[model samples]
Target chain A: MITREEINNIALLSKLFVAENEMESFRTDMEQMMQFAQCVADADTANINTDDTASSSPMRQDKIGTSLTVQEALANTDASCDGYFVVKKNG
Target chain B: MGRIEQIHSLLCKKDISCRELTEEYLNAIQRDNPELFAYVTVTAQEALTAADKIDRQIAQGGDIGMLSGVPMSIKDNISTRGIRTTCCSKMLADYTPVYDASVWSKLKNSGAVLLGKANMDEFAMGSTGENSCFGASSNPYNTALVSGGSSGGSAVSVSANLAVYSLGTDTGGSVRQPASFCGVVGLKPTYGAVSRYGLVAFASSLDQIGPMASTVEDVSLVFDSIAGGDVLDSTCNRDYKPDTYKTLKDDIKGRTVGIIRQFADNNSISPEVKSSMNEAVKTFEDLGAKVIMVDIPEILRSVPVYCVISCAEASSNLARFDGIRYGYRAQGDFMSIHQLICKSRSEGFGKEVKRRIMMGTNVLSSDKCSFYYDKARALRQALSNEFSRAFSQCDVIIAPTAPTPAFVKNRVVADPTVLYMEDMCTVCTNLASLPAVSLPCGYSAQGLPIGMQIIGDKFSESLILNMAYKFQQATDFMRTSDWGVKL
Candidate 1:
């Protein structure tokens, strides 16, 4: 069972700020979701295995086909420095 | 003739202008699309201009692409160059992609008239279309019932005769389940058969763009046009091309088909779906086809495996939407940028999506990583192995597409698992990366439609379509969805 504090903690982990009006609804919804997820938890996977390896196509040779120029790229975004998409500083 | 054949005939004879046909469909959208809520954004002017060009080409006796002048709707998750692709969520309601999805580009290149973007489950997460922020898409058959989703609008548009055919992305049973509920043919091609370059990521490994149409023959025609290799989509199988689907009209005599013993359960399926399957089996058997029954217990665990893997992948894939440079950003006096992302996502994503993201995060958490997620992965392997063994015994497998007809609206929303269970019948095919088609079967006692899913070996779409076409010929269920016939 999820306590009120646990709900708050999960919301913190999920980065969702539960609104005052929505808290009760969130709590109820989360409990129902957990029950649904429990169905997955009930499966017996004793002898099963997983393939977690990442696979992808071979890297292409360094040849430009089509690309956005700095002006074209920055034209759409509000933030621009030499026409590239301005992103936040990595924390 | 089918919709595609009619469009081709009109173009070939110069009997009608492509622009006229495009305008006719646009008029239909203007008249009916609002109450239907089938489209998210309708590209009237652009489509008309494109049709004009195709008409010009035809008038000049110049060769045009196979799908010239045919109007089709695309699921909202696919990026169109100038059109807004909201994925039926408030987060990206105004977001427009600078680049086009590979499929959109192909359709545009083929001169297919774009009707507009269709609605879907928010970020392609839910099985029912009700999860959409735009609005719950009502079934064209009965407004009280739901259009099965996240590709609900795509299936609904075709079912309602709003568009001849439409595109839908299937992750789990998004395409086929909706098609079943809408009483149409929804084909989820083998994972890599269609390119995913433009489709917004849900679960990358499981997502596939497929055709939703009124008939298997129309689906085959569209499938042949769209299935091919693409450099933009790394996961696109280099194998599938027009030629692969072109040779699929042969008889199924001497071909092997399998019916999983577990799928025959009366309790798991509605009587209507079971009877439809029985009729399809008899039709297949009478056509000189060999039918066999086998039990694959691994299918029972498919739901759990699918949930774990899909949620895990969804968590990772959705990480791109962090209220950063693009998408909805929530600003507050007390919060930092990180807190803003949290708040933004919390507010932007709906209840079901947030729940899955949390479940995925929990499974991927370092402490319980191996316990829940890892175990689920192992089951996925076993499921794949079971499919491999089943395929070794037979060339194809047949089962009910869904347990029953589309339920009344808001019935399953109170408990989301009921919605997820809709995917139970369609998820196994995705787990094994097999091609499957949901063909309209008989109708439920309540007069709602039922469908049977014909699953084929990986990349064996030809055989699957052939079988579905034969079965469709034997039954009249597909032609009975007279949503517009005015009873």
Candidate 2:
């Protein structure tokens, strides 16, 4: 079972903040998932070679192509300035 | 003739205008969408505008494509230039794309009218479609049950006749399982067979946008339109051609079908699903096709491998949803950008999405990558190799799409493991990167629909479609009316 501390660490790594109130249920769910994930953890893959490119796709020409204009690119954002996305100030 | 041909004949004879047909679908959607929750956004105005263009072409004695003037739904994950393309998650609830997905562009160029954006599992994560933040899309056959998901709404829309056909993305069994539960036809093309340019990435390696329709012929028609290579999606095969429509009616008299014996013998399979499989095998035998049992022991590991790999990919794919660029942003006092991203993701994502992301992050961590992530990848290759060997002995493989028909919505939503297990029967096809289709085979004792899947080797869409078409012709299960959906 995954402990609350481990759950918090995972949430941190995932860039998700788990509130104190929701941590218990979150930990419980994570524990269940880890239990289910044991199948992969226990599989025998020592001699197997991973073929990541089994479904490899074609490569395209490295040339300029039509893309979203600046206006179109930022159209969905609520905060932008000078063609740049705005975010919270970092410490 | 199928619905597409019927509509084409009507348009050619000037018996009905495109606007009239669009209005009929729009009216049905307006009346039934509330109860069904199948559509997240209806594009009545846009559908009419596109339909009117087709009518003008017909009036000028110009030829239109087979799908011209036919209204269809697109799963919310596929991007549309102006339509709100939410993946039924709070994170992207208000997001719209600046350009259309390649599939959407192909259909648009073919003059197919867009009906609306169908609801789906949040980020296409869950199997029951109940994970949608917008609310679960109920099965049209029985509103009390789920429409198998993450493509549930796409299947439901076609089942209910809310649209002539709909497009959905399948990662694992998203398309076919739901198609089975809803009594419709769902096709998942060979990996990289259809372009994934504008499809919201769930698992880049496994995701393929496919079509759901009432008949195999209609599914083939839509597949022909949206398929083929695209420059934007480099993963798509450059030499791929859309030929399902031309060979859809071809005879499958001597075709060899491999039935995996373990899938049927598994205790998890419901009696109804087993009976349905037995009947489907009999039907195939009666049709003069050779049926043989093939042993594929590694198939049982599919679900676990799928979960590990998909979650790992999803973690990376979904990392772009931080508050700065787009999607839901958390509003509060934040001392740093990191805090803002954390809060935004926690608040914006649903429970299942968060859980998967955490699982993914954990599995891919330095300490666990070799033991878990890399092992899963190796197992994936083994599974693919097993499928290749199996296909060498048989032209196609047949299996139950799901262990059971659509279960009660509340029961499924209450348990995440149950929902995950629902993909047991269908995920292996995706893992092997094979072209597979699910079509209605029979109805359960309780009247829920049962689906049988036909999986073929890579780029064998025409063969799979031909076999499915033959099964459909030999049975009436493909007809929406047989499933209690009114025409």
Candidate 3:
């Protein structure tokens, strides 16, 4: 079960915020959803033989290719200046 | 003839100009879109320009390709340069890509007209089209019912005949389920059969760009056009191009069709879906195919497995949307950059997207990682192993594409878990990275379409398409509405 505090913590980690008005319903939904997720523990997976071997695709040879120009790349936002996206200074 | 071939014949024979065909689709969209809500954006001028070029080629007595002069829609999630690719989310409401997704580029080069960007669930997140920020697309069969999602608009475009065929990204049944609901064919190719170069990332591991159309032959034609290795997408499977379309009419006689053990006695599926599955099995038998029951017990837990894996992948993939670069940004003074990110994300994403991100974050957190995230992966391995063994006994597996047909709008809005539960029958294909196609087997008593998914082992699209072609030839399950251009 998720407490109100745990909801706040998860929200912070998720880079999101939960309003006080929506917190109760949101936490309830998450708790129920997590309960559904808890079904994984019920499966007989302990004896099922499986491995976690990582498979990596072969990386293509490094070569230069045509890419979006700075103007085109930054066209979607007004936060760019001098071919770089400008952001507020971090704390 | 398949819809694409028929349209192609008309163009090649000079019976109709491509410009007139494109205008017919554009006019249909203008008339029906406000109610059907199939398209998020209609690129009329672009479509007509492309059509005119195809017309010019045809006037010069040049032979045209199958997809030449065919009008189609691309799911809004697939990037179309200079056109709005919203993914049906407010977050990227004004976002347009700088380059075309490989699938769109492939179709564009083949002379397919773009009716517009099709609507979908926000970021391909929900099973129902209602999750789209723009609005849910109403089912063409019954306007009160939903077109299943996150490829709802793509399915609607084909079902309502707004476009001949469309491109939909299937990241866990987004393509097949909607196609099933809207009474069209959807192929979710093996994980890398189509390039993911410009398709917006949902669950990167599970996402595949696939073809949706009115018939299996048309689906194969579009798949032939789009499938191939791509330098842009390293993971694209190189062996699919110019293959399936050639063998589409091959015999499925003596092929073993497997039915999952759980689905045999499952109480969750509606009576209509079960009835349709029975009829589908009979049709396969009549076509001289053998039917066998295979046990894939782990698939019973697929919904949760899919939820955990998809949400986890989605959390990481969506982290790119910081207000600084692009997409929706919060307007206000913030004490810190972190505050801006939190505010922007909070306001930008829908409730479902935010919930998933939060749940994913919790699962991947230091303390909870072992319980949720790690456990889910091991279970996934077990699921994959189950599919591998099942395919050893059968050429393809069949399951009801969904537990039921399309739901009425707002039916599951009260409980998000109800929506999650609906992915049960379709997610296993994604989990195992297998190619699967959903074909209309029959319709419910309510007159909505019921589809059966034919799943093949990795890169076995040829067998699946051939089986679908045989089934379509044997059964008369395809239904269309009087919504789009008649011709």
Predicted complexes: DockQ each: 0.42, 0.75, 0.69
> TM-score for chain A of every candidate model?
0.59, 0.84, 0.83
Q: How does candidate 2 score on lDDT? A: 0.89
- TM-score winner, 1 or 3: 3
Write model 2 residue lDDT over B1-487, tens digit each, in one string: 6788888888989998999888988988888889888899999999999999999999999998899998899999999998999999999988989999999999999999999999999999988889899999989888888887999899989998898899999999999999999999999999978999999999998999999998888999999888888888888888899689899988889989999988968999888899889999999998889999998888888888888999999999999999678899999889999998998899999988998899899999999898788888999898988888998899999999999988887772444666788899988988888999999999988888999999999999999999999999998886544222243
lDDT at position B427, candidate 3: 92
> Sorted on DockQ, highest at the top, how do the candidates line up?
2, 3, 1
True contacts kept of each: 0.40, 0.79, 0.71
**What ranges in model 1 sit over 4 Å off?**
A35-46, A49-56, A62-66, A70-91, B242-245, B480-487
lDDT of each: 0.80, 0.89, 0.89
lDDT of 3 by residue, B407-467 (tens): 8887845668788878889999898889999999988888889999999998888899999
The Cα error of candidate 3 at residue B148, in Å, is 0.6
| CAPRI category for model 2 | medium
lDDT of 2 by residue, A52-89 (tens): 54545566678987778999989888789999999887
User: For each candidate, what TM-score against the reference?
Assistant: 0.93, 0.98, 0.98
- Model 2 clashing residue pairs (backbone): none
